[model samples]
Target: MSFIRQNSKLVDEFWEKGIVESCPIYDMHGHMGEHYAIYFAAPNADEMVTLMRRANVAKLCFSHHFSLWATPHVGQAPALEAARKYPDILRFYCSINPHYPDQIKQDLAKVGEWIPYCVGLKFLPDYHKIPVSDPAYKPALDFAEALHLPILIHTWNGSPYDGPAVLRDVVPHYPHVTFMCAHCFNNNWTAAGELAKDYPNVYIELTSVPGTRGAIEKMVSICGSEKILYGTDMPWFDEHQGIGGVLAADISDDDIHNILHRNAEKILAPFL
Candidate 1:
């Protein structure tokens, strides 16, 4: 208890001395639009912007909640509007419905028009209940690869829909498309680490992932911080948890900078 309390104080001091300001922090995974749950902050772009600004976030990459919950077109509106309003600090991802082949085609056709404005595509096979290897996903994946847009895939190890094992098959095939695995494959950091270790194009986003002692360190050791990105799954999860996890990790300042922002700059290079 004493050690835990003492470490907590040091973490507070780390931010008090302005250590987080050393580099621009970019939130690589977030959501915009209303979530019916009362526990979440009201879904509005202005509120989202305010939350990021308070956290010292220089930029945020997010998708619309509607897209993940309902359909692609319905969700893209809010996300696109927010990106247009705050082009400097906000960029969005286009979602596709694998069950609807025409929707996927329409979404991909319009994706080219959102370039520089839309940074990537967000795939939540877990929500859609589809496999990453589905035939419908290939066209969109191909389009993203051709344009060099990063593809953020929600991965939860052991799940039938999308998980590390699913990623293992899909990632290798799309070598040109940067696969940002959300949640570090969730509770399966070992598998996530191995995936990143093996694939140069594979990246990891630390959102709802466990921030236990030596977890971040192990990821850094395996991936070298070049492929690790900081994300807050915001409004649903607190940004401080993600930010403080990396800040308080037992790594060098350079590694901290890379995870906080440098790596995102590289990941989003095509859009920027």
Candidate 2:
């Protein structure tokens, strides 16, 4: 066998299989339904949905800066609108910037009204500037628990200023909150896998880690595919590239099912 076949065997297989390559994979973590700054630009919402539809993305988790980290409060209402317009393609998640004046509660209320439209909640602690475990926003936590909505959050790794808050503290406090830690706690992939091993509610996304060596091996070992989710982090990253990296991991067919799609379906199926 050639080196390319040996290393990217799974990648090739998945590509050949196309959308049917894995279980009903829903992108559990992604952000697009926002006004883009020069620094960050992605295909507009329609284009995004189109891409997702082509990729057979059954569900999408989106956050809006208006209600999230933006000033003057932009409600994720537009995100919900997109979800409504493309019910099969989107699952809106209300966002909270605890730093914003009354945003914590306000976003929660918007989430409540988003009923019949959206599915869960998203937090950008690195960009929003909120302590993950802060009791100040217990309302949001409580709502997630009550609504049985999973909370997906961004975490830091090598990037010095990605997500300022540590997810470790928050996971312990909200045991019932199904938390999807983005970046797989880059600096803490092992820890993330341990959390998944330890807690049923905790899950991890393979957004960039597979691009590295150690993280991929550690993830396969610790999380064992079932608790892992596949997402590219999109525009900032590449879906096919991320998928290629994951397929390159030393894992099995069953493992591929969980990482690429099964786990995501399990997590978001309730809302979908």
Candidate 3:
């Protein structure tokens, strides 16, 4: 066989046949929702698991589409059902809306009821047009602190509500709660890395960031391998790129192991 055909055969024998296994891999950030129209459609829950399994991800923790696109409760129903069907492979974050304080209370109650199934909480302040610094959002932050659950916030630069600076005010208040700077604060990775260094409770989730090896290496250098995690904003982006970026980074094997799964094991220990 030609070299390309030989390589293709090897790939099929290993990855396709599920014989290639690395250290336990976990996808720390992802979403499943039907509302995502043609341009945004992520796979349904079943297809998501199949995708993860093919990629050798042992566990996946995500939030609902309804929570992000429709309403928190509507988004949660499918997540709950998926958890029931794929309890071993799936975990979820409780979506809490700061705009509706009453609904926030209600969701916290649901989170409490869900127990191990609800591993953490996700906040999309920008999507809801609320700032994390707003006092109205305190209850959700407080609930997460009380339970020691991690909070994954959608962050970006130049946004008054979701910017990295908001954490300066919020992280100090909930020292016990672990805060995942989702997407590495998107366009504001530098500031996000600084926050991770400043706050021991803060962490970096690598989703939707630039896929360059240098970018990944820089993040590892800034945040330390222990605070960095592997997350693909799946259904929107390709997991192969996310996985390949980390693999191609000029980091030690131990660091790769930590980012791929060990750090998540430590952060989500309560649930795992």
Candidate 4:
């Protein structure tokens, strides 16, 4: 069966319930919202569910885009409200930007109150013009360390987009906190491999890296299936393109299962 229909299929097909129950895909690191201009066209809460139902995605983790993460100064009450509005279908991660050092504590506090409901945190350091280990945002690193919440951080590997070197600073402090580094760390994958080896909680997502040769296999070799999870980073990566990328990786079926669904199933289990 086709894993996804076009975004319009959710509205056009009028087969939401059947569609949802029919398929078993679950997108762990995808985002949808109208508030951000980067993903201004991304689905809103309702639209997102319709698409999930259409794609037969059993659950979808709403990883809010880098825009909000970059602008941590903004109030997150509205985003929390939106998550509450779609409780059964949505799960939230508090996105942070360390540049707004004054606001980091307040944001973490608010997120703490929302937890067990809000189970994770996300970071887009590149967009915020910082790296994962930047000293200025040490409060966030420390809080995640203490709280033990999983953080889905953005890391790119190449030009046009840059990322942290070894994630050395944060990894040591937050040994218990789960860090799901997104985008396979772009082209700086060697650093990605090394960090995964060094930090057990440093999980990596096999999102847009499917087309690259041996990328998924290399990550699996270094980080293992359990540490690698399925992700689409959708709209930026199409459903067909994203899923195909993972399948192309020459890994075992079981490992693919972990990346595609099981890892996410495990990650969001507490909140679920």
lDDT of all the models against the reference? Answer: 0.79, 0.67, 0.76, 0.66
RMSD of 1: 2.9
lDDT of 1 by residue, 1-272 (tens): 32212445444544664334556778899887777765666467788777777667888899888876777447467778889999988899887778777776777788878877788899988878988988868888888788877988888889887887788888877788889999888878888888988999999988876356677888888778887888888767767667777766787777777888899988878787
Query: Could you arrange the candidates by lDDT from highest to lowest?
Result: 1, 3, 2, 4
| True-structure Cα RMSD, model 3 | 3.8
Using lDDT, give the best candidate's number: 1
Whichever of 2 and 4 has more lDDT, that candidate is: 2
Ten-residue stretch with the least lDDT total in model 3: 2-11
**C-alpha root-mean-square deviation, each candidate:** 2.9, 3.2, 3.8, 5.8
What range of 10 consecutive residues in model 4 has the weakest lDDT sum? Answer: 5-14
Each candidate's TM vs. the true structure? 0.90, 0.85, 0.89, 0.80
lDDT tens digits by residue: candidate 2, 1-272: 53322654555655765455445456666666444563444544687776666566666666654556563445666667677887776777777666654766666776766765677777776675556666655678788888778887776764332332355555677766888878887767777788778778888877767668667668779867788887765545555566667666677767877787788877776665
Better of 2 and 4 by TM-score: 2
Candidate number with greatest TM-score: 1
Candidate 4's TM-score reads 0.80
In lDDT terms, how accurate is model 1? 0.79
Off by over 4 Å in 1: 1-14, 17-19, 72-75
Clashes of 4: 7
